[model samples]
Target: MAVEFASPPGNAHEIALTGFQNLARFTQRSHREGEYGMQALPETDVTLSAPRPVHHLGLLQIVAHESIRNSAATGWQYLVLTEDGAVASSELSIGTDERPPVLEQVNMGPFVQSTASALEGLDDIPDVQSGRYELHTLKIPALGAFLLWLRQLDGNADLFIVLSPAPNFLQAGRIYREDELLDALEGPARKRLEFDDSPRGRTEK
Candidate 1:
């Protein structure tokens, strides 16, 4: 069974694509000029999946297990499809009242690779095979955690796949339901919050 992905909101693709095109042009020129350490560009194209909205959570929000739906959309991420698969990713900042969307940066990290791997395995999950999912990126900076948030369109339980460089308590590449993920994050979130609230932490800030 194949996994069904949700369509992005209005004009998101257009906005992201425009940003990507601009980046690609700059990258090409930079590569030719031997600038910014661009050894070579990847020979790949964009995936069929639309840009996924990226959401962020602070320590307080993570500790509270706040619903991501309440979080504002911070940015949009597009996966680059290599011959091997979706191995690279790029991001675009959300448009504001004062400005339009802008290209942020491109990433070819463990999180990107892990997200691609998780998506490849989604077809094996019965629940995912049965329902449509909207892919979203969730980042918890305090925990150094990144997750592929598969929000079930039918209002069922959502799936959160942990990416690499996660906190010790959370296992990378593991697919966790909302409750499970929150439960796993509880201890780590508390520890982090406690540290951040401490005098030493305050002084560092």
Candidate 2:
């Protein structure tokens, strides 16, 4: 099955590219040999090339073990492909009337590799070819969870695959429906949110 991605806002790519270029320049200057006071700085030459937007990162707030809230779109995640076939990732904040999109962070973590792997194996997943799916990322900060959200475009049969460094009880590379994933995370969310039966702490299921 081919994976599709949602379109990001207009000019987002240009904005992200500009910010990335600025970072690259700074890294080059700072990492150059014999630069005064730069000896102590770690060598961080930003060699990422061909920045491409991959997925729309959506934020999810876990209000309780049985409840979750979908927050506004966080931004777009771009994958940087280098000549060596290595993959890196960067985040750009969504632009608003008050400010333009800005590079949020750059990372060389499991996220990049995991996402690539997921996309590659997407077709092998059972029942994936039945419907069109748009790739997105779901981040649950409180639970330290990040997942590749394959949202079915014309149906309710969405799927989620937990990324590496998977949180407790959630296995990486496993496909889960919304309810199944939520059920598995119930214990963790309850512990994290300190949910109780008391009205003050009770979470609406």
Candidate 3:
């Protein structure tokens, strides 16, 4: 004769608890208390492969900067490397008068002809001990600057390290839109409509 175990107390619709003990093994309960009180659960081993350090971090920086520059939109402006060998992209924009500059996270899409992609075959990318790279565009390329920049970038550790600039077109300190000019005007300038000067609107003087 088989021995009958007591069924867990619950309503008729309650699900059966078959592997409850097995599930409990994975989590731990705390016995102590304080600011550093009991942990939510005991640490468990996670079977994930450690990310390998990027061999070409510097080149990727250049590519990322170049990619942003070539982009049609004033999108991502910065390429950042995380301590754990991950690359993140960001964009900086001015907020309204009530707020400071805003830094937004952006996606690092494909790197075709981008500064980051330029490191593909080059073997001499600089080995930066610090994972965080701050890029500044020293000089906007004039005329054949792109070709010259390419030539200077051929495995040159020095150039890649120093010349990473923010890719916003306005980074050169020039406004691109007519509305931007009008927006900069204060008081009467901004309030006056260009149409007011048209012949149709002019009544003598």
Among these predicted structures, which one has the highest TM-score?
Answer: 1
TM per prediction: 0.78, 0.74, 0.21
Candidate 1 on 1-205: residue-level lDDT in tens?
3545555656666665565555567777888887876434443365535367888766666677887666567787887775667645777776666465566777766776777777778778787778777788888777888898888888868888888777788998888998788788778888876777455544321
Clash total of candidate 3 = 8
lDDT of 2 by residue, 1-205 (tens): 5667667667666665566555555655766654553222122433433233333322223323232224346677766555554346667876557466677876667787887777778887766777788777777666778888887878777788899989768999899887887777766766754643456434322
RMSD of each: 4.0, 5.8, 24.1
Per-candidate local distance difference test: 0.71, 0.63, 0.25
Candidate 3 Cα outliers beyond 4 Å, as residue runs: 1-76, 83-86, 95-99, 117-205
Using lDDT as the measure, what is the rank order of every candidate, best first?
A: 1, 2, 3
Q: Which residue pairs in candidate 2 collide?
A: none
The digit string of per-residue lDDT tens for model 3 on 1-205 reads 1111122122211111111212223323333333333223212221111111111112222323333233121111333333333132333333334343333323233321233433332233333221222222222222111110111212233223111232322222231222332222222222233234546534311
Indicate the TM-score of model 2.
0.74
Worst 10 residues of 2 by lDDT: 56-65
Model 2 bad stretches (over 4 Å)? 34-71, 95-99, 195-205
